[model samples]
Target: GVTAITAVSPAISARQEDTAVAVANVVMFGTLAMLAYPYLAHHILAADSHRIGMFLGLAVHDTSQAIGSALTYSNVYSDEVVLKVAAITKLSRNLCLAAVVPWLTYLNVRAETKDDEGKEEELEGKKSAGGKSVLAYVPPFVAGVCAMAVL
Candidate 1:
């Protein structure tokens, strides 16, 4: 989406730094959540076991991170369940991505149109007032790119 936005509107390129920052924050939080999940799982059971920890990690962790979690439980548990859960979870998220990207593209285009209208109004106001025209900070166009990248 971001890429599409950049392709459509070069001005959005200026927001790449903000996009990177937002992505970094999300990844950092997601990693912390992945690491903390095992601890949370431990308290949910009668007795903590490494196998159960691995299960939670494998089942709940992000698709990319599930590999290590699956390997952790490989010798102790069947690989089938881990693979199934990982694939299903990843598949489900992928399906969501497929649907969401186009919807977001529509939304971004709509927003840009509305913003253009608003900017035109603002420019008119400034012209009438004999003041300098000012440009507002518009969000980056990489929403589509970000959506695609997540998938």
Candidate 2:
């Protein structure tokens, strides 16, 4: 999702909304899976062990949510490690989304600047060609990078 959004450059906000929709869809699916899987597993897989049900819930339901849920249930559940790791992994993925959106913004802004310069040059060819090459776009390419590093 992060990769997809970042690649879309200039459409950061729209892409983010798209990502939210996708995540919402996945969350809904996970919710349904959590409810359905336990019943199926209880009847067919392990009638004696409730642990299996819990594990399946974490694996299939809201996997990321389950990890967070597991932290509080560590004393009650023996296999908390797996659930914790999975939750952290999901969080890591979400963190990537933060980066993706900003990068797309940068790209979009840069592209816009480039386009604007091109248009101005087109309309004022006689004036610009004889005077100087524009440095209007340089601030973003060079100064922006420098400022970004300082930040």
Best by TM-score: 1
lDDT of 2 by residue, 38-113 (tens): 4554456454344543455345534444544444344444545534554555544444444554455544444444
Candidate 2 off by > 4 Å: 1-11, 15-24, 33-77, 111-151
Q: Model 1 misses residue 55 by how many Å?
A: 9.6
Clashing pairs in 1: 1-144, 1-145, 2-142, 2-144, 2-145
- What is candidate 1's lDDT per residue for 1-151, written digit by digit as tens? 2222333232332376676655565456546655655345444643235445445544543455554444344334444454455445544544454344445544444344445346522335422222322122222333443565677
Candidates' C-alpha lDDT: 0.43, 0.45
Q: Let me know the TM-score candidate 1 reaches against the reference structure.
A: 0.47
**What's the C-alpha lDDT at position 36 in model 2?**
55
| TM-score (C-alpha) between model 2 and the true structure | 0.38
| Superposed Cα deviation of residue 140, candidate 2 (Å) | 22
Best candidate according to lDDT? 2
